[model samples]
Target: MALLELEGVTRRFGALVALDQVAMAVEEGEVRAVIGPNGAGKTTLFNVITGTVKPSAGTIRFAGESIGGQPSHHVCRLGLSRTFQITALFPEMSARENARLAAQARHARRWQPFGGAGVFRQAAALADAALEQLGLTSIGDTPAGLLSHGDQRLLEVAMAMAQQPRVLLLDEPTQGLSVEETAQAVDTLARFLQASRMTVLLVEHDMEVVFRLAHRITVLHRGAVIADSTPDAVKADPAVQDAYLGGFA
Candidate 1:
């Protein structure tokens, strides 16, 4: 069975239709890239899957059970997690601390504001492991807000990884990064996903990054899925070429 599946998903924002009858499936331990031009409803798709945006119609299934109506926290508890387009972290806290907080939250513990930030057992170990995996061990002790933009993005990944999620959702993981930094982030992501055998659904505009890391690619246009195929197939698809690549070039 697929790790995640969306069937005829639809979401309307009053007068505007953000997503329309979208259907796709992502297998476990594979990277599925969702791509398209601006206003193609990529972010809206992420929000729907994460439970931040409710779908007006259709079913969302994860690991065989229905999750279409579940709230965000409930979805996370089911081992689904995501990072944002904007860096989302505790600005003043060290990277380790930020990850630790996520670990605690994922483990169903309430956030505590007292005592030594250094001794949080389960969360501490998970955070450390995630930092090491992301090659962020060197800056684990530094405040998240102070890292270079690329490092900040890495820290966000670490936080999501700390959740030990079954399915990872990355909303433009390399957004706002330099060319070199974007490549670094993609390399790190590819390595992390490979090592963990985690399923990934990423919304990205960078074709290089998407084609390099995604096992399959799905194209959305005007809030609907117009094409879904392997990287090479997607690149050659006349519909995809006409809707996106034609203009991307």
Candidate 2:
């Protein structure tokens, strides 16, 4: 079975339809990129899959279990984790601390009055590992708010990775980054993904990043899928060209 599947999913904000009967499947170990112009429902799709927003209709299954409309925290515990388009972090907390909290969330006993020392130790190890993977080990002690914008973006990703999710959802992971920073982040992420082979569903505006990391591309336009195929195929798709990739391809 596919690791993540969405069938006939729809979401509406009042009278405005944000997503319309969307359907797609992401296989285990696959890196799928969801791309589109602004207002095309890419973010809405992520919100729905992550359980941040309840779908107005249709079903979402992850690892063969229905997840549609489940709470975000519940979905996260089921092995789905995501980073937001806007960098979400505890600005006052050190990078390591931020990651550690995410790691702790995965532990069943994390909310206990006295979770054993072992739980804390494991969470710490995972946090440090995620920071190292993102090349942020040197700045692990820096406050997230004090870090550069690029560093904050990478830190958010590290925090999500610390959750050790089976399916990672990244929403514009490289937003607001310089060309150099973007390249560095992409290279680090690429290396980590190669080593982990984690399943990923990405929503990104940067076509370069999308093409480089995605095994398959699913294009959206006006709240519906316009094209879903290999990167090259999607790029060449006539509908995609007219609707979204007019000049990017």
In model 1, pairs of residues that clash are none
What TM-score, over all chains together, does every model reach?
0.94, 0.95
Judged by whole-model lDDT over C-alpha atoms, candidate 1 comes out at 0.89
Compose the digit string of candidate 1's lDDT tens values, residues 1-249.
888999999999998889999999999888899999999999999998989988999999999999997899988878998999877898899999999988877775443444355437778999999999899999999999999988898889889989989998999989999999998888888888788777889888899899888999999999999999999889989899899988443
User: Candidate 2: which stretches are off by over 4 Å?
Assistant: 108-116
lDDT of 2: 0.91
lDDT of 2 by residue, 1-249 (tens): 899999999999999889999999999999999999999999999999989999999999999999999999889988999999988899999999999999888665544555677777888899999999888999999999999888898898899899989999999989999999899888888887888898999999989999999999999998999899999999888899899888677
* Number of clashes recorded per candidate: 0, 0
- CA lDDT of each candidate? 0.89, 0.91
| Model 2 residue 144 CA deviation in Å | 1.1
Instruction: Indicate the TM-score of model 1.
Output: 0.94
* Model 1 CA lDDT for position 21: 98
